[model samples]
Target: MLTETRRVARIVLLDPDDRVLLLNGFEPRNPATTWWFTPGGGLEGEESREEAALRELAEETGITDVALGPVLWTRVCSFPFDGRRWDQDEWYFLARTTQTATDQRGLTELERRSVAGLRWWTSAELSATRETVYPTRLAELVRTLLDEGPPHVPLVLAPEIV
Candidate 1:
């Protein structure tokens, strides 16, 4: 099968209470298979990573008043979704917002269909959940960010496939 390649900007959105926000969704072709992921999508036009991150966050999570923070991590991953193989280079940014509630008004048609819901997750909840969470080791990395702060150089995560 052919692969579609893209660079994506993702957000690790946190609330005042330090709860990370994640969206619960499933593969388009396989509804029973679900996962939680940060709000993000591929860059559009000539949008910079920061612009894409903010746009995607607003569109996917309905939180727009937040400022984009430094990138905390980056990764390259290959995976199949909706019957298409994708090679995505992704950057995860750290963003904090006082806005906790989420709305789906801005989702594209595909997003409206695939996204299930959004929720704030505590470190304990993220660490103990048996369900799949994208980018892997999110719990550990988040703890590091909260405890020590963003590293000078963004960490490059090991590539993953799922």
Candidate 2:
């Protein structure tokens, strides 16, 4: 089977307390398995990665006033969602905001069904959680970023096998 590569833009939105925002979602084909991931989605036509990241951030969450930083990381992920196999190249941007209020009104039908919850996670929480999280090394990465600051060039994360 030929699998098309999809470009995705994601944001690691940090709150004033350094907690990162994540969405909990599950594959429809296997609802029993769930995972937490940063907010993002496939890019629309002609949109730059940064533009798509900003758009997805506003659409997925409700805070739109945050200033986006540089692309902090990139990762390739392959997984099955719904009934289709997806091979995604994801770019992750960093943004900080104090706002926590979210409006789910903008979510698509698929998102409404697949995304069950959203939460802010401190590094400690992320490390201690038993729940599955994508980009598996999130806590360690975030801690490094927080201590050392964003890199001059985007970091290429190892591909994740789901």
**Each prediction's whole-model lDDT (CA):** 0.91, 0.89
lDDT of 2 at 82: 90
Clashing pairs in model 2, backbone N/Cα/C closer than 3 A? none
Instruction: Write the residue-wise lDDT of candidate 2 on 1-162 in tens digits.
Output: 788889999999999999999999987667887999999999899999988988888888887878799899999999878987789999999999989888767788899879887999999999899898888999888999899999899999999866
RMSD of 1: 1.2
TM-score, prediction 1: 0.96
In candidate 1, what are the lDDT values of residues 1-162, reduced to their tens digit? Answer: 566679999999989999999999898888998999999999999999999999999898789989678999999999887777789999999999999988889999988778999899998899999999987899999989989999899999999986
lDDT of candidate model 1 versus the reference: 0.91
Give the Å error, residue 53, model 2.
0.7
In model 1, the runs with Cα more than 4 Å from the true position are 1-4
What's the lDDT for residue 107 in model 1?
A: 92
